[model samples]
Target: MRIPVKHPWTLPKRLLGTFVILASIGRIQSEQKSSKQPNIVVIVADDLGWNDVSFHGADQIPTPNIDALAYNGVILNRHYVLPTCTPSRTAFFTGRYPIRTGMQGKPLSVGEPRGIPLNVRLLPEHLRNLGYRTRLVGKWHVGYYTNEHTPTRRGFESFYGHYSGYISYFNYTISKNNHTGFDLHQDTASTLEMRRNSNYATDVFTEEAVKVIENHDATEPLYLHLAHPAPHSSEAKEVVEVRNMSEVNSRFGYIENINRRKFAGMMMALDQSVGRIVKALGDANMLDNSIIVFMADNGAQTEGFLENYGSNYPLRGLKFTHYDGGVRGVACIYSPLIKNNSRVSEQLLHVTDWLPTFYSLAGGDVNDLGDIDGLDQWSAISLAENSARESLLINIDDAVNLRGVVSGKFKLIEGAADLYGNYYGDTGNNNSYPEYNITEILESDAGLAITSIGNSLLTETKILNLRSASIVRCNNFTDFANCSDTCLFNLQNDPCETTDVSADYPEIFISLSKMIEIFESELVPQTNTDVDPASYPEKFNGFWMPWVASDSSTIIATSSLIGLINILLHIFSLIFFS
Candidate 1:
């Protein structure tokens, strides 16, 4: 059967031109929704190492999905984050250094009243103002002392995850100071009964993220922050949790260390989660109009309390120290909008930059975010321009007597950082797995972007080019053994702070030290309070909850009702069994 068509000769030329104009206008209207505000998906991996991902030249455990994303995007070579989770998150959310908000201290402890200061606005709140539906899944470690500090109150429309730093993979429980409590929740309500058997935290978060993406309204832009807790150790005594023992044994048989093997499995789970989330976006037809940003919160805890045995490899120092290993994180940005893709960017980008950067990307005025430490670098990232950021105030904690600042290529450090400052991991380029082709990953839906950019298929040559451009190969300097206070190292020459060049370059040292002094002047005194016994989980029916906030009444009422039922059950047990 021949398909009937409107004959061109049937209408006048002017009328036909009018019809063409109308059709073009209709097409423009249909595409305007996505073109106006693209969906923003920021996936944060907790405590991931600099050398852990395969893109960074690690081969022991393959992260094909992550590598595919990186290869299709710009691999951030000099991306700097804080040395720990809480501070890093504070910077990312607020687009300001932690020092400005008194969040410069350690991670928010259990029952601590301190949070990203209530006065300081967050990224989600700004995105929300731009008519974006904001949702957070997985870790909310910045703060949860009060109802106002929680994700829902802090700009996210919905929250589905734990309130604390880390929780058990299966049970969703956190242990601190010999006290155990259920931390999993679905927007201020404890998800105790909703917990699925054998459902790991990483998998659960991934499912929730995919659901959010699938169910999201296409008209309204979505800002989904999927913060995965995998690779970050749980609060329990058995820190690392590996759901698939069989796969761990088979895939990571080369790794002799038990914790490292477990870490590899956790990474595998996270990589799978990344793949699934991207697939969900593609399945929903949101890929072309979406931007995916993947980054580790901070560096890995190589060997310490709550260590997952992650490797920073050639980079010196562990999670708590101010070294490239701890601060220089794994990061990338993948989107069709980006002109510069499938390359490594050596631009200096700080965690705080994301706030203004993302806001500008969402078509918001940077002036609205007044006096923020984060500089907008959307142009620098997307167009491969020189970064707006020239220097980075690494950190300053007077309590610990530690301070660090990076100016140009020179980095200045003071206080005791030598304890964990040593090269880690022997498996740098041991077993390179280049078999996971970026073009073959149909789930990620990044191949089209790669091929569209002048027929680049993310080939082996391009992968090597990207990896070589990003990976920091240290010179293994064996100079003056003294690594005490007031140390200086040129990060350009010594990416690993193996040698102290402070005495050699006095002017640069003085300049960076003065830079620290300037940042210190803006520091807010730490407001972290002692753990309030009233905030204990036992008081709230074995669940971590807000205590001193106005919204505590609802939880209190629920706890009272459950307590009454428990007492009634005890009385019945005495009457029956006794």
Candidate 2:
């Protein structure tokens, strides 16, 4: 009987194993139970430069509220986007390249009616399908040329903003459209004329945004897209104030001093809008659960009066160029999931990344959204991984096709052309002469010499000799062969694009050129609805008759008669001299 009584060590060991199993089961259950879905809000600014924000080292502007987000969240040092509005917006919405979405050219004008194609599914639509409420407030430039691409048809349950790209801050009338009227909408119904002389659009947009947030149901997760069209082109009121300065004397000069002041003011207004949105979320007790993102659509346009006020500084080129100044921008993301508040310098993310990133945050299967070019950058931002995107492609204007490829520290840009040349005829055949190699010119002290050559050619052949030569003849230059290979520069040392380094790095030139061809082949040419004007109600087939005013004499005579009547009436009333 004593021999049969075994020691109790085995019993204790069995008890320890049971306890360890229970602890493991408890840990697994806790992790599964604690998983949560987060809300998302994306605030985008149009044509804002890298130095525009205070957090990114701007002393002229104060963006305390925006800086707070950067301070709290991960500040992305090398984020890239398209050089124009439509392309950027399309990329963000569809999670595909702009060229893939068939938005590769200049923005669809007010006259041209085209929208997001039916085949493509937007981010909001996918989020909505997953039981999230999506709302879009601000400028929707993806489609206005047609009804099919409207926000309602895309995926958003609610839309509040203008269809055309730009509107008068005071009157809400688009200047190019001759003050033709349009109304802002909420869902299917038009809510207001979107025109106000006393109230600024920036302020009004913020107010409407707050209202939208307040109206959203707390139980349902919300995705709010706040797109601000401020700090793009300076408003007339702000322009007048800065144009009087001696440094900005020319109203028509490139990058005028007044433009900067006005742009600063507009940026301030946008910052205030951000403050309002954040405050609204806090007021609703939704801050902790919401993922907030703030970024710019593209680079600043320094042409005309803008250059006198805003400077891309170390970055070469402007909004229309493919240089770092045009594509590189400030991007920040704030979320509870981000463990530390540090700058993320590794990942080279793009606008398309948002779709998959948001889907993962919302606790949905990202693969369910189907094919997309953007990768999920969450792991990179969370410090779980260290990697960057290999290449990012962007198209600025219709005439400029640019491909930027970054490998480690070496960045190469190919097929750089000037869209301004199409307007001025300096480059001759916007298609033929590639004008300048940005990397080459910015690397050397002879940067000015290169620019001077192009400037002199532009002045002599295009601007000064405009009346003598036809548009075709003015832009037809056969001298591209002489300088085509001479314009390349090393961007790492010369970010300002001042020198030509093609002589030393011949391999880079060939690699970048090949990359450019590959990129171009993938692009599906966007149907230019602006060409061959067509009236509404007609289904656009990429072809329309050229716009020609019928009965020109009646229109001219009526205008002349009205002018003559006003003069005669003034003369009779003795008001002309007064």
For all candidates in order, the CA lDDT equals: 0.79, 0.58
Per residue, candidate 1 scores C-alpha lDDT tens digits across 282-370 of 77877777889999988888887678889887788788788888898889988877888788898999999988888887766688677
For model 1, the local distance difference test gives: 0.79
Model 2 RMSD in Å is 22.6
Worst 10 residues of 1 by lDDT: 1-10
- Each candidate structure's TM-score, on Cα atoms with residue i matched to residue i, is 0.86, 0.69
Scored by lDDT, the top model is: 1
lDDT for 526 in candidate 1 is 76
Measured with C-alpha atoms, the lDDT of residue 499 in candidate 1 is 82
Model 2, 354-464: lDDT tens digits are 888887776556776667877777888876466546666555233544555554445565556554211210111123323222232222222222232221122222221
